[model samples]
Target: MNEKLKAYRAAILHSLADPSEVGIEQSYQYFEDGVLLVEDGRVVKVGAAEDLLPTLKGVEVVEYRDALITPGFIDTHIHYPQTGMIASYGEQLLDWLNTYTFPTERQFADKAHASDVANIFLKELLRNGTTTALVFGTVHKQSVDAFFEAAQALNLRMIAGKVLMDRNAPDYLTDTAESGYADSKELIERWHGKGRLHYAVTPRFAPTSTPEQLTLAGKLLAEYPDLYMHTHLSENRKEIEWVRELFPERSGYLDVYDHYRLLGARSVFAHGVHLCDHECQRLGETGSAIAFCPTSNLFLGSGLFDLDKLERHGVRVGLGTDVGAGTSFSQLQSLNEAYKVLQLQGKKLDPFKSLYLATLGGARALYLDDKIGNFAQGKDADFVVLDYRATPLMTYRLQQANTLEEKLFALMTLGDDRAVKETFATGQSVHRRG
Candidate 1:
């Protein structure tokens, strides 16, 4: 029998458990001098350096000295087609979709364009230290195919779907109800659970989907066990008003999805800022999570999300950089911006809480906590190693940090892609540099 190759000598720091389950500080396990043994694609063992270092016999070692290692950031929501339209001029969510998003998404009908964007999108994600994401694709079926194809090549755990907007969108972007479900189901059968890929049942928003179209989306969700549902909900007051006009028979915005049975664990609704108290309660009760896209909310003049209020609603909240609308791709930047977003709401948000939202919080939202989002024994070794002194300012700032939290706090506020020293996925070296 052939001996398995091994890579050792990597710093190990990961969420020990659900921070929400055990207060944030206790939830993390960081080994100052640590070692991870990787064989094949999964993490075989992780422990202290003194114990693991001695086992190295003819094995390669990646020693990222003084670099802080943590699980890769998980983005709960983003639009793959919006890669080119991320920083377009000022407009609210609805208008932004019409002027920038719809026009940009329409181009996905071309397979070449989709493939090109897919490649660039995945590169940007890896560069920004994001290992997993729930992405939105154009209504074109090719868009999902291209995105999944790119993710597969990169070996990323990506969740995305074909947008379904049967009405209330540009004619070019809209698809018949039948075609939307069929294409989505086919994509699901092909990609869901296929080598780190998961398909999301995507509806642009309640206003754009007819009762029948939404019902069809709900049907798809019911049929596919373990599949995720993605959509926009109560993002803006104007959009909520439009939804009210569209679904007046329902009690509120969330009710539309609730009635369709789309409110449950693994259902991710982005930009839930305007959700009422009752709506928040429903989301919490149903176990549906909200992706708090602080950057996009601020970029589009969207209202600040009530994270404190929503968590009280028992809603699991995660972070997102609603790209294009979201000012940056780096989850570090998202954490930085999320701090200010909560600050503006007169809430006291500690930096650790911010980091938790980006990492472990997202894992919980996606229900992938058991697998990714942390570095534990028997879990995938998906983490990014960051240089505390990645830049001149960060190097200078390191002097002020005496403790781990202080160092991490400085990193979130003062870091970007340049801070990523190395990135690893499933025990493989995907990005390495300082």
Candidate 2:
């Protein structure tokens, strides 16, 4: 009976547990006809519409007859500065970075240019039903500043950091150990824990950063206990060899970061495509997470991620578009690529598990599950409304689905940005499809 409450009626589904840990039947909850109630940007309740509708006296419900509502998608790793260069042609990881990524990121040295891309990048996320992301900016401090400004204006829960790269790259994009540390500290003080924004100490990777820079990056983590440490790991074969050459004293690629004291509960490493069993075990033991970027792996010709092996080692895994190399902003597309990635290795990615990785799994990886993932009471009301009939093909395909699992499988296989009918952040509509 609360007048301030807002209600929406739709078919709702959300992940409650990882299907890899729990059986598929016990992993998620679904309501054929559900009602989500919100007040002051928080979920008040979510239940079957028939049960909740009868209890309300005067609350108006916004109903979507042919749509599904689910927790907002989360992208665990993305480069905000590379939004313009997605799908840049035919080079593997190292060459691609030098050819496209570094040059494109250099443009962010201009605050105005960074601000302009931030606006477009965020809107693209909303359009694709992604409400939260762990983003990477250029070495330039202004890139992080501009990215945070746009995120704050939208009231989005976002984590970003300035790239810390000191050596083995173009001089134009490099930052000294002292300068990188100082700039990152300034950004953390200005933006970390400011509303829904958080800071990450970002080292490009083991090869780009010297031991001095890596040590200082770890020091930042010690200085701010709640901050995140984000970086790339074992994504490509050449990159792994490069790490070995750079840090021969270390045991392996992960040991370089480990030697610098970088692995922890808040650390998130992107593209663990080439990780060994020991590396996976260490990641789990330290509570570190990995971003499984399927599209980027495929596009860059990086090896397929052994998701089954990672799960066996008890490591937390999440979905990352890894755009521009990732090729699409849609989590559905990421899920689609994920399915194929698993298929190549003779493993299966069930539809429930796919949804979990994109939503709750990503949140857990980013250590924000308690605040933003799923439709739990008291969590932020960030969710997406997806239309089954978004396109002629989708409408036709969904009509053939016999069960919720079948419907979800079809959506992940065929859906894209067009399937996102509307996106809501904090219970307020932020994007509506034309």
Candidate 3:
């Protein structure tokens, strides 16, 4: 194909294949001194730097010395409107939603506000080295429009939607059931595959949406099963009690979503911190994903996620910085806190698994695995370069690191936006050190 194009040499480390692949761990990094060749923003060749360098005698290069390269972090769930609402007090999920989330999201009805937040939202993600995210917009169509508009301008792979809440929310923030379905359907038709943007059917949760609205949400998902489904699940006990009150005929919390045919490989739930064994079984059976937002869970006093039970169930889990309630947009921070979340439950989340969840696993959970998750040949050229010596403490520890795993563990625990030296999307430099 026209002999390819732009090339760069760096310390390249891509999750070369799915972690389930035979040689994923050892081969996670393709070449220590690696050459990543890109043509028209798509990766064409990946090999040893020394080998590929000689072939391209006069091409421009952006070499990152001693920087660790990995796939750009993929955030499976985040609320763009909640960007400024992070770090608010309290632990109850519902209270936090009503107090901070809904109020801030209400501002999205103003296009200027939506646009401003959308710009800041993307900048925060880029600063933290996340190239792709499944985001939630407010119940306003302008919010979805404003978000997609910003993503389109910035060329980010953003999946978002108009939040659907037909009842139990502030009157100003709610849409009627028919309007919810219609607005979402229109969004699907207009933005589902526009540019790198995709649409998600975002029902706030069972409590806010009536059965009619939830059923329409399932129908919309059925019409575009390829698109992602984003929502909340059993994040708290009181919330489960509220769901039972909302849908008394339901067997359990997750059954509320399942009753409407909203269970599938493409379905993704956020903050499943308190999901029980039966719920996990159904999620596993349907191949749906759970987005672990540890910081948010902790911020709101939600209990520790049962990582052991989830692992045993073979549930597909991904990492998220559920911004606003989540406390930070850094997936590195998500990885850091994810370790603590597991530790509290008497389980350990290995460093590799943490990083993998941020990259490939997150992409898989969103069903974007075939597209932008990892850096194998023929895949989209998305990469993040980390400066190992980004901070004084980290630099000191890197010298004492016994293995790549040790070095990575140090980075995950200590790293933040400072560690991100550069971010690339489709082989284009989206962010770089100042």
Candidate 4:
């Protein structure tokens, strides 16, 4: 018996390529009755159970009936400090930040509060079937310290950074250029490339950061080997106008970050809902990525994102819940809104395409595809088991699904946290439905 090995038998599916690049039929692989083989916290293989079961002489196989297994969902953009204020009432981008976000983030100055919220945040992600996320902390250094401590305790692959807001924010939540740089550099030194955890140099947005702070953020990326740059971009029309007013020398909103040398393969900009064609082309040329936060955009009256335009320009895109303004922690809910966003633009979001955005697309956007996305051999075995019969209505609806695509579409449209039966990270069960 190989005690180090574990296997799960279920209906398994995973994305192999983008449907936009490969045809829909060739974008994914699925097995009606499949076996996922794991050993020592990594994937060994995934294939039909009939072909795999006979080869396993003395390994234990956990069978999940009426469930589908797939790679764990990834959230490319979310604010961990704003977890407490998720669904806060009406206000656009700027007002929302001043009203709900800043006040909520201020509490993170208390290490205990930060730790408490970190616990709740991670649990909620697992409950919603999310295993990896690029997160935001408050301006307080202790906030990131607390978050990393909690994430380390669980051995999860998470990325986060302390916010850098020098101006255009409440005084209580602001940090000077030097202080922000020193704090971020210290955090990068302590957390980046530590176990399964990474660090992101998070400047709140172009409007919040001064040229000096943005330069320092670029410096941090230059100093570190694999550090990430996470920030907001072009979410609201007024926000764009404000950015233009702040940085009059720059051509546009994206140029402000570009002039500071912040564009790169590891950079992720959230809510690029209002970018122009030139901006999209520059992003693609620089190999930068965007976190498509559909729910937040719709909730805040931000404009619809042009996923087709971004794709046509060769940009990489991922799904982001953008919690606090995003209205839901479940990626399924994000996908539901994303479907509507694309529909409004007269574009179709194929079920396979939606699946890719939530999983492999997110991994590629984060530049961690080799480690966390899909069931590729030697990749971390992070996955979720989804119960098709999570509710009576869902069960009834799925029974009428005539094809796999229809079934997947129904799951995204009608599902929420309830659809997540279990979630695993590194081959270990981290969440199980009661």
Model 3: CA > 4 A from native? 1-4, 17-27
- Per-residue lDDT tens digits for candidate 2, residues 232-336, read 999999999998898989999999999899999989999999988999999999999999999999999999999988888888898999999999999999999
**Tens digit of per-residue lDDT, candidate 1, span 109-190:** 9999999999998888888899999999989999999999988887888899999989988898899889999999989989
Q: Against the correct fold, how does model 3 do in TM-score?
A: 0.95
lDDT of 4 at 370: 97
Query: What would the per-residue lDDT of candidate 3 be over residues 1-434, giving only the tens digit for each residue?
Result: 23448777777766654454444465376577888888777777778988888887666666877578888999988999888777777758787777877888778889999999999988889888999998989999989999999888877888898999989999999998899999998888888899899988999988999889998888888888687889999888899898888788989989989999988987889988877798888999999999999988888887888866875677888888888888889999998899998888777787767777899888888888888777667778888889988999989989999887888889899999999998888877888878
lDDT of each: 0.85, 0.95, 0.85, 0.94
Residue pairs whose backbone atoms clash in candidate 3 = 86-324, 91-300
Task: List ranges where model 1 is wrong by over 4 Å.
Answer: 1-11, 18-21
C-alpha root-mean-square deviation, each candidate: 1.8, 0.8, 2.0, 0.7
Maximum-lDDT candidate: 2
> What's the TM-score of every candidate structure?
0.96, 0.99, 0.95, 0.99
Candidate 4 lDDT by residue in tens digits, 1-434: 88999999999999998998989999999999999999999999999999999999899999999899999999999999888898889798889888888889888879999999999999999999999999999999999999999888878999999999999898999999999999998898899889899999999999999999999989888888578999999999999999989999999999999999899988999989888899999999999999999999999999899999999998999999999899899999999999999999898998999999999999999999999879999999999999999999999999999999999999999999999999999999999999
Residue-pair clashes per prediction, in order, are 1, 0, 2, 0
State the displacement of the C-alpha of residue 41, model 1, in Å, after optimal TM-score superposition. 1.8
Candidate closer to the true structure by TM-score (higher is better), 3 or 4: 4
